[model samples]
Target: MSAPDRQSSFGIFQALRIRQHLVVMAIAFAAFALQAWLFQHRLDAPVPPILTDFNDYHVVGRMVAAGRAIETYDWPTLKLEQIVQTRNWSFMPWAYPPPFTMLVGLLGLLPIWAAYLLFMAVTWLLFYAAMVRLAGRATIPALFVILPSLIINGKGGQAGFLSAAFIGWFLVFLRERSAKAGWPLGAMIFKPHLAAGIGLLALIERRWGAMVRAVVLIAASFAVATLVLGVEIWPAFQKGTSTASEYLWTGFYPLERMLTVFAALHRFGVPAVAAMVVHLTCAAALVLAVALAWWRKARTETVFALTVCVCLMTSPYTYDYDGVALGLAYAMVLPRFVARAGRYELPIAVLLSWIATSNYLWSGLRQYWYGVPIITHEMQLWTISPIALAALGALVIVVLRRPARPDAPWLRAYSWMAGRKPG
Candidate 1:
């Protein structure tokens, strides 16, 4: 009844919540320990299944070292390199653009083990630093929230960290200046699909300086990759994409492993045309939401977070490891969402999302490596997509329902964008 009594009760409840978060984090750390051990254990095998994707990165890097960088796009040649280098094979092909090929090709300059460690080490540091910047005051909690995705990315030795870190920097910088934002956007040339959505977001928001810089950087990178690797690399990469998708239609990539609505629908035996229609429809809706969010002048963080969902939904080949950007986006927005909702359920939903993005790595390890039949292909096709849809809807709803504060300095991220004048 008294104000002092109520204040005391609120403090106590807050303390309780903090303690609960710590406990969950402790369990997560323990799980991470086990996961690290499992990754190490798999490495003892002559051809570890865990390295299949990384093998693609490393072997292609080796191709560059051996003066055959462009050949990485040659499916048989790349597969042969994997067989020779790591004695493992992947159904996935090397569809990365030349700039990324060159980056990883430099990794081929090192021994496989050293390359893996060094690549992970550098990117791990950048990823943490970038996420810290994104999390701002919520750095510690954000780390825990993204820990699952971090584990999954590390386990598979994927480029999730590098790509996600780029995204983190892009979001942080976009709020500061338009041109400065383009640097990270350009760096994402390695994964152009991911960058494309973000680029479009800037375009819709009318961040012209950023758009110019990103275009220049992208063009320069492509020109350099072309000069160094040869003109043939372009066609090779395209042909490989065609080859891979043919396999995809035949179920080479399991729907459970992919995080797109198209994959989920196709998994359930929907017709290919129907699946594409559904996916494109969802993508259109999300992109439109992002445009509207920006037009309404929502905070930069909220808009960028929504953009992440759109990128994942629009991409046909996103995997659990590739969900790192989404995970980091969730972490970046969690504090604000919690503050605004002033309730428990939104946080819980976010946590459930982390769980959803995390399980694929564990499930694959169990079924393919550890001989445990815990999760099967038939069961998880719908796991990650629903979260993407839900997050998009929630963000759009919140953006529309609640206007940004009148005094917020970031009324517009780019003053020159869309004819806005400073106060």
Candidate 2:
């Protein structure tokens, strides 16, 4: 073909791709609109219940704002505090550490409904914007790719988006090999366990600068928490953890809502001790695999994708909303996923996403199911733990035939990528 002919052909291809993505973005916007509708007009009750994790957050915020911060750990007092919003419905004991209490306490500055909407909306924006900064040219298509996870998170008032934003920016900084990578990890101190992968990656790669900064930020969080809530809040937080664990163990908290390896095994009738042991074993293996992947210098996209899965698998208490990170993981590897050049790619991608995101996020659905020996709930079975392992394995196979290249230009905005102009 002549040079002019080739240039014209390429222009046409670009136009078609842009058109496709625009179509996808439209569908994503529609889905988000539907989610807002559901949140506003509750079908199950005249109003959305305070049964979500937000109840604990709202009540604790009220306590802290009302100078009853210490009573947040005291259930009798906390339950009475919840009566204002949660009423006589079930209460979710505060399971977070003191640092997170500061965040929840800020929510008390507004009414419960207002706080719920604002918190969810802000975190949702954070997650989307953080991912877009990394997604770059593919931002439009990526929106639809992660739509289900976004819908699930916005449907309820949970911290899923906060965690997703952390993971998203953490990857964005890591792609640039910047010290800022650790800053996000430090901010995740409220749910530090979910950040296991980043810590492991830093140690394996000898990223001392990033690690040190992360430690400093963590210490700062503790200092701020102490300054705001007082040193005694630490002991109260410790006691609260015990109470929360007991409640989860005694079945006051639904095991079916938990998406951990232990929860899956326990649902299938495994003893709690045995299930926990298996979960720990799986987590340890994931750490080793992710470390090895980084050590051998696999593609950064592959390694980071694996790391996202590793983080979820290692976190024992991550719930459905937390699946947002899993969706982000899929987006990271989109250009390189299996069947990339075949007609099956998009369909296969959607299937994998559904398996990762699940379908039990809505309310009023049957919460229980029976299958002879496997009397279990819907999403509680696939468990983010096993699903993460599955994703890790699938990623490895997809890249098995391709030469390992330490390249990830799709993760744009890395200052190094575009001549290091320093964005």
Candidate 3:
């Protein structure tokens, strides 16, 4: 072949590849735009009682701003439902801590619709920033727009984006700014279940400074809330927590909407006691794995990624929207996976992405099975369980492949902090 002809052929191939890339990106963007429009439209429409998670936050915020924070949680479920209906909003149980209510209440000072829009905008920005920090600029469009979880979050007015942003940035800055990392970790008190593993990791690593900071910050948040709202807020929150726990335990919250192993078991007709035992056992195993990974000094990104997956598995109250954190975890680990091209890396990435975006699949299944009870029941079971477990399994594999070395420098540094000599 002539050199000029070969060069021309190579150029043509490169142009073709670029065009293909552009085409895929264009498609992804279009999907994002369509999803966003649908989500906004849904937000504008009145939500059903069964699907009013966002309204709960807004109402709680309004209560807090009105100095009725304690009353918000103290109201009986039926009374609360009545009030919600009277106000022409959907029924949504308020179960978050006072700190979250206070934050949302500040937003509630605005008109409800305006507050909703602003809250979503701010949380989306935080989510985008966190993604960029963890995944780089390239992933922003796909994650912020094309990911089904984002759509789920926006449509429901859920706090998943806020949790994702806090957790994502916490993981990114954890190694370098250990002390400062506690702030974002502390902010996760808004959804305390998500912070459960953060505290566990801090304690396991004997990161006393971060632990102290997190405790102080969390305490301060509550203290400020009490001062502003009144001491009664704590007891109200406790009562609400108890009610929430009962709802979860009794399956009143609907097993089909949850993504945890416990809920999956419940949906499959496992008794509540048996499901609880299985769920607690799995949660313990995941926590132990995370502790071991940190103790052995796994790579920061790997440990964070593993923890995020394990966190999702640990909590019984999670929904598909909350899997935004899992998406962030994938982002954290992607560069390493791509660089190494490990044997299972591509499959693992695909599985995680599928799980993160599985809502689209589930939605389609729901549409197809619209009025078929038996099939719909099976679909609910499948959607809530299998993909989540698959994601957890894939994460376990990734963690096993990327085992921490005892002699890693980070362990030595940690040992010094713990007043022990590194072996």
Candidate 4:
């Protein structure tokens, strides 16, 4: 075939690919719209489950705004049952720190319903904007609409969307504007566990400026919160933390609802101590992986993706919505995955995508399928952790096999730090 013939055929293929992507995006958006509408109407229910988590934030926010921050943490004196009855809201222990309470208090200024919608909308927008900036416009469908985590987060009114958005932008700016990256890293203080792995990775990479800025920002946030809410809030939070930890271990929170290594093990009838040991071991391994990747000067994008995955793996408390960060990680490495499409990579990608979106489907099946319930309730949430672990393993393999581009800036920086000549 002539060169012109080959070029024309390639152009046709590209156009076809674009059209296919557009079609998939259209379907996803339509599905999301329907879900949103159903959530709003709640059918026959007076209150939709979408407000479950948000109500906690809204109530706590109102309490903080009304100078009742201390009461939020003082479970015994707070009379949570009475408060719930008065407010007509669900019971949710206020486990977050004072800094988070301050932010929530601002949202409390609005009506609960309006605050819930606005919070979700704002976080979704931030997530989309960060994703577009990092992965480009073509990747929006996969990260924003198709990912089941976003849907879980939207419905649950969880902080996962906001956390994922912060982490996504942090990764985007980490290499080029290291100091500026601190802002998003600091913002992730609301869910400190989610940011723990990345924090360690930053330390390993000797990103001192970013680390220092993040520390200062976080400290300032806490300090400001203390000044506004009073120092007693910290001790109250500490007590709440202890209570929360006990609740987690005693199975007060259903194992079927938690998507963590510890919960997965416990669901299988492992002793609580043994499950915790396994969980800690896995968390350590994930941290080590990130440290090793940083030491080896792996590609910045690859390291960032790994950091996100490791964060989820290590976190003691993770729900389906928290997988939004995992989706962002997948989006980060997607361009490279496309460039070097392997036989196994496509299948793995498809499998992980399905797993990310399977929480609700799995729950429904467990509830309605008699056989499923007979098998085990733990299987509902346990299924997510293994798939995520496998995906992380696959990601690590890909990163190790793919050498850094010689001219990548991070490679040069690493070389200088190690006293080696930049190749």
Candidate 5:
């Protein structure tokens, strides 16, 4: 090929890619604008209407407002009872630790609407930033805005977006062999168990700088909590953790899903020890798998997939909203599979994403199985469950079966080819 012909071809390809990006961005902006407008003008409820996890923040926010040191376990109950006693609705006390409580309290300084906006913006930004960093250049605008996990996170008022983003960045930093880059992980301590799997992976990989910085960041959070909420609150937090565990296991909370070993045992009247054993077994397997992969020097995408799978499997209480991590998980595996030119992975991803968006999102139609009830809820369950399971199976296969290579790039931004190892 002539030099001029090659240059012209490259220019045409670049222009086409740019055009596609613009189209995607335009569509996403329009959708977001429509959503915002509807939220603003069509509301029948009060401003800042609480959704799923709003109570968590509300409990802590009120405590901060009342001048009470937030370290007390009783504060969550106090906040819950304060509303529940009069509202005739059950309130689970704020279950987050002192650091998160204080952070939410800070959020309470703004109007609830502003807080919500800030939360969404920060979470979405972090979420995509992490995906971009981990996947390299394949970070599509449509993938960001239209992902089912993203919708779930936004709808449930959960912090999965930010958590996934932070975890993604941490993994990227680890891949780069940078030590201090993992400090952002401390922000994820709101759900300490999720951090556990990732931490173990870092340690196994011998990323001492990342490990040390993560620990220090968490310690700093505790120190700040003590400074603001007092030392006495620390003991209360410990007790609160135990109390919350008991409450959760016994089905005292709303929307209990007992898929975890602990929850399953509690549901079937089995001993807690058995559940703990199962949980430990799964966690150990995950850690071992990740360590083996690291030893073989697998791609960053592989490591990320293993980390996510381990976290979910080990978590005793992963609600549907927490499935937002699946977006990151899918991102990790999708590129490598795509490189293999598989027909199924991307389509399966699209379908699972559809289900993910459809089942629990706020903005979707809830028609009765498309205006026909062919066996009612049973049919719906059959359709959704099998599909979800199949997608999950595909994800697992991709993560476990992929070959290792020594020369893969560290993931730096969202792309199918990021951290790709030569076969």
Candidate 6:
């Protein structure tokens, strides 16, 4: 083809890609809108959620209004029972301290439908903004936000985007300067499980100021909850956590067993005390791994990637939609991986990305449990459950053992071709 003809074709292709992207974005928003409407109108229809889980936000909103605390034994009887009986505004109880409950409550002030809209939009924007910041470019921001796992979070009304943004910001802050790390790290405590892996990273780096800031922020949030809701809420929340595993076990969700270091032992009939010991030991070892990695000045993005793996490896209930964070981390690091290692690593990256987001769906379907939503099954195993935990653990081990020298290109190539990276 002539040069002008080739240029014309390339321009047309670029235009088509842009149009396709916008169409997808519109469809995503429309899906969220439709889901929100269904949730508002037919929450009692007995049909399960499609690809997301947003019940927690609704429950928390109501609990805040009624000034009720989450109860240990009364898991299934939250607001649904009352709504089923009387169609009243009564909602299920919350399981968090007042600060968290209040935050959701504040979000709830806008009608639930409105809250859902705002949640989707804000999360999408924050996720994109943070990704752009991480990549030092806006080129793939929309692509990052529209990822399947992320859309799942938006569907369920979960705060995965918020978690991603905070974690990304924390990483960016640390990279920019150790001094400013404390504030963003503090913001992270809002979703404790999501931040747990990164917190260990902070501790490993010995950023005392960051550690202090995190502690202070946590204390402040708790203090605010106590003051606003009463001291009874903390004890109530603790009780809720203590008994959460029991309720989960009774549920049909996959990996009802505590699947992390803490829950893994518990699942195998380990005694509670022994399980706690194992959990603490594993947690400590993870912290040490991150600290060692930091000491060696591993790449900044690697720290974030490993932090994500830590979540999978350690958290008790890492859900599949929460795996969106893993995807985000991968997006940030993939370019660097490709730039350093090239096409050899491409296939592994594709496979890992697929499993990271959809493994649960495929696993569940393969088991012939077609009755359940693919996203739900995905939540069970693809999230932070054992399979994900195993995958992430293996990834981290690879990261730690891989060659560190620049001249060791062969080792890097081998590792990449082998489809391994630091978590």
Ranking by lDDT: 1, 4, 2, 3, 5, 6
Q: Candidate 4 on 58-124: residue-level lDDT in tens?
A: 6677777788888888655444633452334343567887898888988768765567667876787
Over the full model, what C-alpha lDDT does candidate 6 score relative to the true structure? Answer: 0.58
The number of clashing residue pairs in each candidate reads: 1, 1, 0, 0, 12, 8
Error of 5 at 86 (Å): 11
Q: Which ten residues in a row have the lowest lDDT in candidate 5?
A: 374-383
Q: Which candidate is the best by TM-score?
A: 2
In model 6, the runs with Cα more than 4 Å from the true position are 1-28, 44-52, 69-94, 137-146, 178-180, 248-253, 256-286, 340-345, 363-423
C-alpha lDDT of all candidate models, in order: 0.68, 0.67, 0.65, 0.67, 0.58, 0.58
Give per-residue CA lDDT, model 5, range 242-325, as digits (tens): 887776654564322222445444445556667677767866877788888878998777777788767665776655556656
Q: Candidate 1: worst 10 consecutive residues by lDDT?
A: 413-422
Candidate 1: list runs displaced more than 4 Å.
Answer: 1-50, 340-347, 365-384, 387-423
Q: What is the TM-score of each candidate against the true structure?
A: 0.78, 0.79, 0.75, 0.78, 0.74, 0.71
**Which model, 5 or 6, shows the larger TM-score?**
5
Question: After TM-score superposition, what is the CA distance of residue 233 in candidate 4 from its true location, in Å?
Answer: 1.0
List clashing residue pairs in candidate 2.
61-105
RMSD values, in order shown: 8.1, 6.4, 9.2, 7.9, 6.7, 6.9
Residue 294, candidate 4: alpha-carbon lDDT: 78
Give the Cα error of residue 149 in candidate 3, in Å: 1.0
Off by over 4 Å in 3: 1-51, 75-91, 141-146, 336-383, 386-388, 395-423
Q: How do the residues 1-423 of candidate 1 rate in per-residue lDDT, one tens digit apiece?
A: 597986775565556545644554466445545544554455567645545466677778888878887787778887777777665666557878888887887888876666777777678667767766766435545555556667777766788888888887887777676578888888888877777568777787688888788889999999998888889889887887788778666666656766777787887778878888988888888788788878899877778878887766687777777777775666656544443442444555556667657656645664766465444443533445555546645653574455434433333221211122322
Task: Flag regions of model 2 displaced more than 4 Å.
Answer: 1-50, 138-146, 338-349, 362-364, 368-423
